[model samples]
Target: MQKQRKLVILGDSAFAEVAYECFTHDSDYEVVGFSVESAHLKRDELFGLPVVPFEDLEKHFQPGEVDFYAALVYSQLNRLRTRLYQEAKSRGYRAASYVSTRAFVWHNVQLGEHCFIFEDNTVQPFVRIGDNVVLWSGNHIGHHSTVEDHCFVASHAVISGFCTVGRSSFLGVNVALANNISIGADNWIGPGLTISADTEPGQLFKGESPAASKVSTKRFFRLKED
Candidate 1:
């Protein structure tokens, strides 16, 4: 810890706002404001913190003077936060990471720089996590489980408490992995998939959906142009 630094959260969602609360409660960084790309500005305030445009935020808080956290949850375009990570680095603001004091990180576990691991994560013994990783709430990472660089693990995903998560992979919410399974690099595991074997590199596995039943127009509401 060099100086008590200023901070700017890069999103306005609950996760970002809550992280602000978490950081302030445990650290000395004062959160200056929230920021986002111009197109998706929500309200002007987040948890009583002022909101600002991402491009112009540097004017108010110099990049070197303050640090930033992406704090954006993964959704349709999971790569969005990755892009923001690069953007922040290019602009000279060091990215900050927050590992919750409540997490069960074992002695042999390793976490890289800029990893924001939140509450209730059970990172077991010998588990290794790479740089730029984000582990959301209440996940179970089993012993000897290794998550590579730049991966995102959604809330409640069960990484069997030996499993190896590959680099740049995205594990959807509630994903279940069997013990000793190794997922390859650049793969995407969709929500609720039960993976029991090693997957090839660049593979994607999604849970099967049940067949949809045909319905008449009366089953759904329709709005007509006025």
Candidate 2:
């Protein structure tokens, strides 16, 4: 086996833990430590590794020696992740991308820095994924689609062929983008919404919740209890 690359994950949250598990088990990355901002540092240790302040992380782990992965959620339409990724790049630290071994990514697919593609994701040929993008489990990225920088696509989201998801966009679970559609920057797409046309920038879209029927299943089936 090849030697594993030394890595530092910049977060101490659930996302960071997930990153550690994926990188450790499936990839050639060895997680050395976790980090957060000094003000947000809750504990000194995580997963038996030292949790350091991100501000001075370079002092402890040299940029040339260790790579960095910004493990963050889409708290601010993925803008926070983008900012942190840029910060790591400015510090001369190499950003790492985690593509799960279970994911089916085409050879022609292009992925950028700090991307996290989870298991069961099917990325088709000619797909272009930009920096700091997160494709959660079971997502289907169609052929020739472009997901721009800092976008977060949740589980089971289906992006059709030739679609363009703009920068810092957040796609909720089961969200479906139709063919040739364009999702604009900073757009927040709620779960189960289908986008068939181009969306304006910084839009908030929400799907209606399902209402319960008045008729019960037992009544509808006309089944008698023994």
Query: In model 1, where do residues sit more than 4 Å from their true spots?
Result: 1-3, 208-226
Q: On residues 160-191, what C-alpha lDDT tens digit does candidate 2 reach at each position?
A: 99999988788899999899999877677878
RMSD to the true structure for each prediction, in A, is: 7.6, 10.8
How high is the lDDT of residue 21 in model 1?
A: 85
Question: In model 2, which runs have C-alpha deviations exceeding 4 angstroms?
Answer: 209-226
TM-score of 1: 0.81
TM-score of each: 0.81, 0.90
Provide the lDDT at 24 for model 1: 86
lDDT of 1 by residue, 44-154 (tens): 887787888888877777878889988876543245677787798899989988888888899888888778887899999889999778898889999989998778998
